[model samples]
Target: MAESCSEAGLAPPPELARLAEGLTDQARLDGVVGLRPGRGGRRAAVLILIEVGLDGPAILFLKRSRQLRHHAGQIAFPGGGVDPTDVDLVAAALREAEEETGLDRSGVTVLGVSPAAHVAVSGFDVSAVVGWWHAPSPVAAVDPREVETVRMIPVAELTEPRNRARVRHPSGYTGPAFRIDDWLIWGLTAHFVDGILELGGWARPWDESRTVEIPERYLTDRRDTSGDVNAH
Candidate 1:
């Protein structure tokens, strides 16, 4: 018999611990968390802070400012490319999160990291680092230079079959997105959402027909966080 998905709780497994530990060691040498492109290319790292609560953990995602170039108003983790001045991948992640959403990093316990993701839009190979933030947020200020808004989706919602779907963008990319109530979490943010769910062993077989429809304005601005919290 196959293992039931619900058997896995909202905590990371030993595999996750091993991966996270390895990243720290590797970062000591290269001092970076990034994806290696096919050949000569640029790679960046993004931090997906998963705030675990009594109800489990909630994944933190953000909406980029509409005025930006590349992937504006698209949902993503609180991160950007690696800075040469940074000490390592973890530093880069914390720095970006501070710059993007001003979420205090002192309380975060990093569980581990998912595999590096390659993005064609920004031509970046990105490493999504997972951490647990234990503090009251509604967070702080978001830097106007990058992010515009921030949202948190409960981890349990990602495993719900009713919340998952393939978001087809006009850019010719049909990819993952989750609807939890009102937020349409697609693009890079969506990918990490699924991966984190799998890591927690909470991946449910969601019905594709039950996809949460994205509001027209979801593609343009910050989420309202009202009404139904759609899942993906």
Candidate 2:
């Protein structure tokens, strides 16, 4: 529950295995395509989730405000469209994390970078960046306009085998997830989350049948809720 995760969010979490050397053959989803034809310039950003001490390790996720134009009320990693002032994707990620979660960027270390993801739904060429929040703290509600709720989910729970769901869209690609509590960790977040789990040699084989039909309506809405377009 969000209530429980918040309580656990107050404590110090342990370090996850950031051993990147063994992940050479990791299953990576086809990342962003050519920054879009007239998609203007590249806006890179880092989306870092901290697994503070509570509940093993907690992933920092955001519930976007319903008033927002895209992906309203969906659970997502706290980063955004890259900015011109950003030094690189890492800087943009940290900067965006601070703006969205109220977590200070001073103590966190850049672990590694995941393959860049282009959300077919929202036209965002996003790079999922992983980090360890060395001095994690309770993130105050910073910009209320975009973020409605800032929450964390457990590392162990999210990595559990039982929550496995193999989602096959009308498209050919299939993805996996460990649905922890109320959060359905699927789509791009699930894909990259699995990549991180692979860095720990924790990849568990999941059934191709375990399913969740992402509605067709989600596509036409043009929201980044699923991060990819269902090629129906």
Candidate 3:
């Protein structure tokens, strides 16, 4: 059974009730946690924004610009490091989403927050803020330098067995992955998506043994400029 952290008196839409109820700390969701020794304590947050579309519940994702120094050409949720002026992680998430994708903050209803997860590669403690797009407004990549595309992918397509697989990085790291057209969703982002599927009872049996290596194009030269590592 999923745990609940919903705001008092706010009822989530039926399509998201399960997820809202099941929402808990990322560690319980099987997300990456615990920082490596000697890592700094930087904080960040991401918005896991969902909406009920014609097909069903869909998630918002943005493709990072290939020109970025790190995590280039990768699909990620709209987010970034917490700003000092922001009241909390939730505000940082909404602000980042709005800046990256032109998301109308007024239309989003924050469900709750998933406890922070330690992203070792980036040395940041990141939180996932769940939200419902009850009244979605026009969204697009507001900056070509940071974001290249904005896509709303249906959960049905993501849960399909044919689109699910495991991905192996050259570092010997292997984890859940999802393939949509030519885009490969992997790393921490994929793990969160996988957890969401299971939490919402939207998961389907898939071949875990079927794995693919991270494509050369998606691999970054870590020796260069330091920036946010794979999707937050």
Tens digits of lDDT, candidate 2, 140-180: 55777777888776667666667778666555556665566
TM for candidate 2 is 0.73
RMSD of 3: 4.0
Per-residue alpha-carbon lDDT of candidate 1 for residues 41-159, written as tens digits (9 for 90 to 100): 35456787766566766778777666764445656677767789876666777787877787777656665554556555445656676675644455643676566778777867777
Tell me which of candidates 1 and 2 scores higher on TM-score: 2
Ten contiguous residues with the weakest lDDT in model 1:
223-232
What is the C-alpha local distance difference test score of candidate 3? Answer: 0.76
Q: Which of 1 and 3 is ahead in TM-score? A: 3
Top model number, lDDT: 3
Candidate 2 Cα lDDT to native? 0.57
Error of 1 at 123 (Å): 1.4
**Number of clashes in every candidate structure?**
12, 6, 0
Q: Please state every model's RMSD to the true fold in angstroms.
A: 9.8, 7.5, 4.0
- C-alpha lDDT values of all predictions: 0.58, 0.57, 0.76
lDDT of 3 by residue, 99-159 (tens): 9998888777777676566666667667777788877899999999989999999999999
